[model samples]
Target chain A: MSPSDSLAATGEDQLVSLLTQNLPQSARTLHGPGDDCAVLQNHDSSSLTLFKTDCLVAGIHFTMDTDPARVGAKALNRTISDIAAMGGQPSEALVTLALPPDLPLSWPLGLYKGLRNAARRSHTGIAGGETSSLPKGAPPVISIALLGSVAPPHLVLRSTGQPSHIIAVTGRLGGSLAGHHLDFKPRLAEAQWLAAHGPPSAMMDLSDGLAKDLPRLAAASRTGWHLLPDSIRRHRRCSIHQALSDGEDYELLATFPPDLWPDLSAAWRLQFPKVPLTAIGTLTNPDIKSPPLSGGWDHFS
Target chain B: MSPSDSLAATGEDQLVSLLTQNLPQSARTLHGPGDDCAVLQNHDSSSLTLFKTDCLVAGIHFTMDTDPARVGAKALNRTISDIAAMGGQPSEALVTLALPPDLPLSWPLGLYKGLRNAARRSHTGIAGGETSSLPKGAPPVISIALLGSVAPPHLVLRSTGQPSHIIAVTGRLGGSLAGHHLDFKPRLAEAQWLAAHGPPSAMMDLSDGLAKDLPRLAAASRTGWHLLPDSIRRHRRCSIHQALSDGEDYELLATFPPDLWPDLSAAWRLQFPKVPLTAIGTLTNPDIKSPPLSGGWDHFS
Candidate 1:
């Protein structure tokens, strides 16, 4: 579709590319858009700041009747997952709420309770917040802007994968919407451990399922990829397609050099005995023909 | 009103107090909520990072027929004003957009145009952004999270005003919604100037109007205040009541020591001759009686 098409026709990815093209990027922006988080050169000489924002709307991310506390937890956790994807630790967050003025205060208070618990557990400070009234008949929305910190050596990026890299995913996937989406644990400690240990060549979070997210990581790394047949680890009662295409997994997806696999696997098993880390695929040279790929959840399509 | 009351009954300020009370505040949070921005202690001891977020909703901040570009600019500028309020220079921003899937692609592109121009002018980088499709019949929304940097000596807060301090504001107030709200320039340079020379004891932006915002500053500073008779500088064709209560003025409200007013005012004229700095009030002892103050814009009220 052309740029003149509606957003539904253009789709989220293409629309992002079109809108971000020629964006006014400052010299301080070490990495701009297209990554899990934007990396900015802060005053600290050794560390970079990770910046990301995510939003949840009533009737979209959650129903109006959904528990307000869960809604708030999911909103902040979504952004924290992005920080984890970059091997960064969340530092602070700013929350913006848009709701109907007539709504009971308990809704936001409950939302904030969820937010406070999630942030406290993650060691993220709630720095500031703003609230605005939505027009009549509009659904409520919660948007979070998070700042994270990462040492330059520990910073993982989506554009650094190479051919022969083994693609691995953390934990089981699929059927997350049953309840997991509301309370999925962001793989922050695991990602940090991976970065401090073998340090994957490239990494990102599995929010849009392996089918969609894997290809994105591949494209960003300037490589192609092929998933091993029946290699994906699916959740109980979930089909293989669901494992490959269901979104909101909030798990780590990383690529490691083949040589590091043996030791890294042993260490990962020891470090995270309860969490499963599965090798799913390998990055291939961009020039090579890629295997057929299934599409995942798309917001506008 | 009780905390259990509806948002409209509790009002914006009381609701904010309820929601943010006992929030997760990390050790790195040098200054938390109740200010224009949160001051975080960065690794660089010489400087601090400012974090703030603000949002705009269709049918509230602007109508569907309003220029899309202006909407975009306004969204980013509102957050930037918070940064300016802290005497900081904006470094980067993360934008989150929630819109209908059927929206024309040109709408977002135009919005980006406005965001790009405003960011370029302020030397702020658009770091990363996210977009989500709103459910059917949902209004469009834009939220911006901005990061800014301030040197230690230049950092300003809203809780430092003292008795007898001169309450001054930059530029004329009121009548901003007559097209000015959408395109008004944030007083970044002027604020940075004030922070550098005779840095105000307390400072904030006039978002909710002087009548409301002034008392907020006074309360935060643990002081009472009185407006000098006929001292408010109103926009052309605006009544004094409008000047006192019309919100979205987006001007700087600061308290400075009486001793520095002469030299500071003269230097300000040299630095920003086109902008007027009006002395409208004075901080007073908390025990003193305050004249009846009119309330300004309240989202819930």
Candidate 2:
């Protein structure tokens, strides 16, 4: 294979799309791939099962010297964030770790402590996990697969946004690597509150920033977006560009009907007074061109 | 931490024990942490859900030059084998990949082809997955998490074996690394047949060779094993030691009541004539001393 055909050149988004296209789907699969979580038909007609998997690799997600507890927390929280994006309640999780043999026992012990604490806080049970040896010089890799459930009527999906829907985000974006990536709580409660009251037309977590993720949501819903640049909320001291491009901001990016925005915003203010819900844009017709966006995190970049 | 306190010094077994101790469990958890798969209560009281996660790391499970297709098959098959051990039917899977950016995109495409073929044959759906980049020079890692289900009456567990139960294994054992490790079919059909006919007292897949895994089955059931060395059925031309320690056999090892052996063997021969079912040992009282057996795969050793 030539250098141009390498994964680096193909990029994460294109590679994932190429690999997952026309993959297997069963009668039980409510929705597969492309969404934040895969939705599966459950025995109970009233709810559906949500399945997702994610990984955190050292040198990419964290350094060897980083606090092991936070590393563990981040690993589980990332997957939980996917569940939260679907307006689901996390039920159980299985973890897998590939570690270099020379790592101290204390590292994994601290990691498990964090994992246990995080699972407890989310009401998710840590069902089981396995550990294996990595190559001599390789860094540790932590992977988690989580199972969650959502009531059929409340399950939100990225492919349901409509033209003219008001686009909004929960909390500030950008500058997540300055410790927020490791510490930000998933918007599980806030999402559940929205689902219980009245779910938005579409919803997803902004892990890869608005520049990349918003486009994905738009593509999935067969719509375009018109961003209000001045309304895009930024983290403390972050610029508008950074707010649009910097990834790892685990905030909810959702769309609501224009008619429901007034009541939804008022109710959200009363429910989660501490977290900011900022309306930043509106969905547009698919033919309407969106402003070019760049600089969001890309793994193979 | 001292060198003696490293994970290599503690061994994989001890390390897993240290990390998984007292993990949180919920009302829906039927079994957690020790079985081949974690069993969770499903909506239908007649059946339960089985969840498991396993990973194949580069340099550990396979080398860079190894066929990407085989690597992909092995990754999914390994986790599917876990569900089969519990007499369950594979349902859906989520795959996560960590790859070095410079690797050719063709590698992942081939891997996905293999994954799709395996899922098709196993009647499993590919729900969804995530991909991330590994550091430069790092090899690729593929991790799979599978969800399966088993009828309540047919559920099998390693912890339920009894003294005097006849221990039998499906097919030959050991020397798997020669070629079988990559191509051996998981005994899903055979296990489900057994469950439908007469469930085993206890069962598990032999991934870490009989010497290690049999002891685990015994330990879990509070029993001991008495092996009939002459009766062990080894792969063609494999020595007794290799048959006992090569690991990655991916065959079912099960314990049955002595009284049911004749009828069960007769029925199994008619059901799966090509597959050999050999009775190799019997469970002994936990306090009884048996011949010391050693040599099995251990990750950190």
Candidate 3:
């Protein structure tokens, strides 16, 4: 079979793997391709540049009836969340919009309003963008590339977890489809606090749900996970399975040393009183197989 | 009429005006929107960051018969050309691809290979990207966001031209549709040499043809331009009208002090013996009534 046929047979995961496996790494590239953000050395040696890009398609991410402003807000928020995941400060963004030729002016205007509002809240500037007309019947597509920076000492990555680390998450999970995904604030401040205090060994935003994302962290760290289902916090009316696989939670999942759990929990409560920070699992030896959980989401699936 | 209807009534230019009219500008922003790239302050304090984004839709940028690698290379080259226009060195790029649901894996792989190859030649790294499946029947779209840096003193802007300055362009223009658009290199080296020597008072790439883009530089500089039609360079067998209106030439358009023209031309010939660098016009007083030229490509026209 041709590469195309084999790719179609295998799916999106394989496609992503094939696309990224052999990219040339530059001298300044500290982390490339596999992380939430590509980390690069800034001309200023004090900080590292964080680069990330994400896309939101109208049909897949939201319906036409969804508020245009929320659509805009979610577009920027998704990339902002990635920066937050890296314990970085989002500084600028470039937005690219592809719309059907007949899209109403108000719709795009409202979207920009939402984007501007969210960007202001996050202290990020929308520096530039490109707007184009797609084919007559295509849906609107929004893609944002966000740039950020973090002090090297405060930076976090999913690959740094250890076998004995306790897994903790901030905020409830699941039912993001009920509007939480569009409105949740990126945990930028919380991440900075964690990096300064608890100093997570590993960290990432809960974009694809606990079940799907936990495995990524585990795989990155070359470990496995042992989740205590009862300890997992869920939104009211959501099941453990739903909490584990609904995705788009926009919460923070992190690993802390077992001994630091008490001090970390205390500090988190004091720092973010309304947000719940719960310990739900522990990193384990890779050889220990845990119960299988449903995957959160796959764009091509 | 609804906002959409009114927007359709007013057209793309009006829509662009509405979208950019009141955008919040940050303190670090040196130039925002309205240019080939947005300029921002680098933390290093010695240089400025150049940010630009451009998108290529299948039907708009290329056809199915177009090589997939060329499609990929063109996507990156578009933004690299923007950086070159600003006299900067491209350092990183983030690519976002939206492919048809059943696109052969070979297609996207070929596209990435082209993108990687071009990025390598330009000294840019493919740092990160997002991939998604377009709705059934929708065409492929590729968007790229490029980042670069330039010494503060070497920076160029389209709005900095002065009356009496000579207008010059590097390389031939027009007939890009015949395949030059897909294969042409962004004038990165020529731009750097010009910035270091002639130090253009104003600069921008000729993406939307000379007739259309010259007026942009004129409007931004608050001046008018008097192009000597006989002096304009054209691709082999291309007419003067085609040379003036055919977009996607990807050549550098710049202004230099009339006193420096002889030296600039001599140095340019020595530096790029194969690429033609021709002076075709002079910036004029804004009140001058130069012959009107037709506008170039508009996304929603």
Candidate 4:
């Protein structure tokens, strides 16, 4: 078996298509497979019930050369980002570490330190995990299973956008190659804000770059997307490709009703004065003749 | 990683054992790693909570030739056994399946179906699970997590036996190599019965053969055990080794006060006429030594 991206190696489109094709109704699951989190109905929590498992492969996800703490932070951050996409607040986490016997004690401790610190900052608990020592040659694999809860009516998902909904982004893009990927925040507060006030429809995190991830959310919602390329490229001033395809931005992409555009910007600007939420595009009724955002990542094909 | 039994291969035991040697107190957890279930205080629960997790690897635990349904049943039953060891009723289960794409989908479906059947028989809910395909060439692994409940304070555990406790077992043992390993019940009912009525001081399921697992329970309680080899062998008309080590009998093992023995057996006879609860041995406060039951199956070791 390969990562979800690998399925796309046959082509990214096919991977996403296959993911949703055979999904069981999962009635017990208020928000199922397609969303960043699975949701449950709770009057106390309009929040989406976020659940995600992210595995960090030694070679693919990170190398030993990477700082142990940063590696740990990255793992937790990635899972948090998934919950963030659905506007959920993380409540608990489980970290399963599969390490080779040769790894020094300092390594895992560093990783744990990083995880513990981040959990503290996020106000979430690292509930528990399993630790295993693989054979000498086995790669270190760390998998994090996170559970989060979000307010229901405020639960923003990737498949709720519609044609004519304007696309927007929270915070600037690009420059993750400089190591921001390992240091990024989960955008939890921003997501909660969006859910409470504007409550944008069709939301997701920009991890594999907006260019790749945007199209995914768009296609899932079965709507075409239009972007103001100049606006995005102009703000970053970096190579447009970096702004488009460079992954791990950890920003939020959301769609909003045309009438709420001003309030969306005003509210975003008022709250996170420094982190700008910029309008990037509009959703259109998709057709066989058109595609949403842009191409995406594929592993196997 | 090497299996759990391969503790010395990587100098990890110094650390793993160190972390586990003396457990930290948790206000919520009734039983930690030393027992099959990590019992928690569920204030509203009219019953005791029992939780456990077990993992199955492709090459290590089972192979493609093994029936997929059996694999599924094994995963679920292993966890159920954990609860049974605590004299608890099975409540709910969740499965996490990590597969290789090369394997047939039919296998996974069969596993799901079999697991569902097992859960149904246990009268537990299929809470749902997260499924993912691992990186290419990774062995297929299945892990089942279970949640169960027993009458509060009646949940028997490994560390509670007394020196004067009388050892007892339910049902006959041996001949399990005849496919009993693949289709074993958790002995949940017998466990509950003993927990509530027999007044057992300690209880656990005989899974890793009586020899290996019984020692583990004894060690946890810091007690010594004296086995009745003749009595055990006579009951089954099998070799002492077969009676002691031929495992997967899935029998309920418990210890109680000597005076309770007659009533316990009589009650068991009335409640489950087909299964007899008979005395086997007694706990000892002294450094008692008995022959090893037999190292039944520690493949890696």
- Candidate with top TM-score is 2
lDDT of candidate 2 over B157-273, digit per residue (tens): 999999999999999987887889988789999999987786899999999999888888998999998988778899999988888899999999999999999999999999999
Q: How high is the lDDT of residue B21 in model 3?
A: 64
TM-score to true structure, per model: 0.98, 0.98, 0.97, 0.75
Candidate DockQ scores, in order: 0.76, 0.70, 0.63, 0.16
Clashing residue pairs found in predicted model 3: A104-B4
Expressed as tens digits, the lDDT of each residue in B1-301 for candidate 3 is 3575644465666676677766766778888878889999876789999998889988778887788999999999989999999999999888898876677778888999999999999989898788877777777889898889999888989999999999998888789999998999999999988888989999999987888889889989999988887788889999888888888999999999999999889988888899998998899999773777776766776
What is the Cα-based TM-score of model 1? 0.98
Report how far residue A42 has shifted in candidate 2, in Å. Answer: 1.2
| Chain B only, TM-score of each candidate | 0.97, 0.97, 0.96, 0.88
Report how far residue A104 has shifted in candidate 2, in Å. 1.0
Q: What would the per-residue lDDT of candidate 1 be over residues B173-272, giving only the tens digit for each residue?
A: 8898898789899999999999999799999999988889998999899999978738878889998888888889999999999999999999999989
| Residue pairs of candidate 2 with colliding backbone atoms | none
As a TM-score, model 2 comes out at 0.98
Q: Candidate 2's residue-wise lDDT over A109-130, tens digit each? A: 9888889989999999999987
DockQ of 1: 0.76
- Native-to-model Cα distance after best TM-score fit, residue A4 in candidate 2, in Å: 6.9
lDDT of each: 0.90, 0.90, 0.87, 0.68
